[model samples]
Target: MELAVRAPTSATVDDVEDVLEKKKQWILETLYGLVEQDDPPLDKEYLSSEKLLYNGRRYRLRVEESSVIEPELIFDGNRFDLLVPENDAINTRRKRQAVVDWYVTEATQKLPKRADDYIQKLGIDDIEIEVTTLQRRWGEYRPGHVSLHSRLILAPRKIQDYVVAHELAHFRHEEHSDAFWNTVGTLVPDYRERREWLRVKGSTLTV
Candidate 1:
């Protein structure tokens, strides 16, 4: 998070300034990279044609509002069909929540199936999976339970599997020692690529 420059004692002020100007592109890229790690959540108005991610694929959201109908969301393979109350035209929060809630609900139903695959592979049992909002990490592990960020459901299947494997590896090794990484590798050999993708793009996984 720190950026510094060095200059010889004999160098004039203009020389240092010139150095900064010459390297401005690099300095800006470096700063932008740092900011991207914790980039702000993706902002949306929940309107038609907007992009929504699920299982690592971008699908256009089609919003339909009605006065007498209940607000609901449906995924029909091609895109999301969002049915909302007529007031959603002026009040977007409710429409947005419908989408968020759908993701959590879907995550609860589907994500656990993936976790079960790994659990069997790792030969573990009685592990509960909770999909909820996680602030700082993609996944966290305790002794007998695994909590995944609901947003993680937005990632591709491989990426999601890597995270699950990562947390499950902690079961065998609490600390991130060499044995832990070796275990992770067994589950996800390309974890480096998946981890890097999440690091750079995790912030964008939002409704």
Candidate 2:
């Protein structure tokens, strides 16, 4: 971790030293917290023994070699069977990307239908839904478009539904006011529970 401090242009070295001296405890605590983090997904190496969370269930990965075509990842309700192209090197980053591609493809197939279900239920039309990687947010909504984070496929099915409902609710009310939450509740009565689940476990949803 790099430490950077921004002070007023006219500030002296002594001023900066005094400020850092005062808040040293808070800074150390923050740095130590980051250093001690052990989030499995964030540190995934994509090895065969390393497991992945799909639809909120844990499954170990099994790698195999195939010469005919491209790499393919298959889910058989028990494990992830990945068929790597025989000529390609099964390096960590490549395997991780294969897993990420699988998640994006699965999200492409699944999220649209779920969003459409809510769309039909809410009688909202003309809102385009997209699946892609997002730097921070799980779902985004504008006037006529919504983009869902591809990594959201790692979440439970109910949580996925909540994200869709949350974005669709924005079609009616763009802000998180009571009226907006009421609309979301109308669409998904148990959204609060799913939202809570995300708050507690969402950070682990990574490739």
Residues 67-107 of candidate 2: C-alpha lDDT, one tens digit per residue = 73666788988999878888677677777777888888999
lDDT of each model, Cα atoms only? 0.78, 0.79
What's the distance in Å from true for residue 42, model 1? 4.9
Q: List the residue pairs that clash in candidate 2.
A: none
* Candidate 1 Cα outliers beyond 4 Å, as residue runs: 1-35, 38-42, 67-70, 86-90
Clashes of 1: 0
Tens-digit per-residue lDDT, 58-117, candidate 1: 999898876636567789988998887775444677777788888999888877777777
Model 2 residue runs over 4 Å out of place are: 1-42, 68-70, 87-89
Model 1 lDDT-worst window of ten: 27-36
TM-score of decoy 1: 0.78
Error of 2 at 166 (Å): 0.6
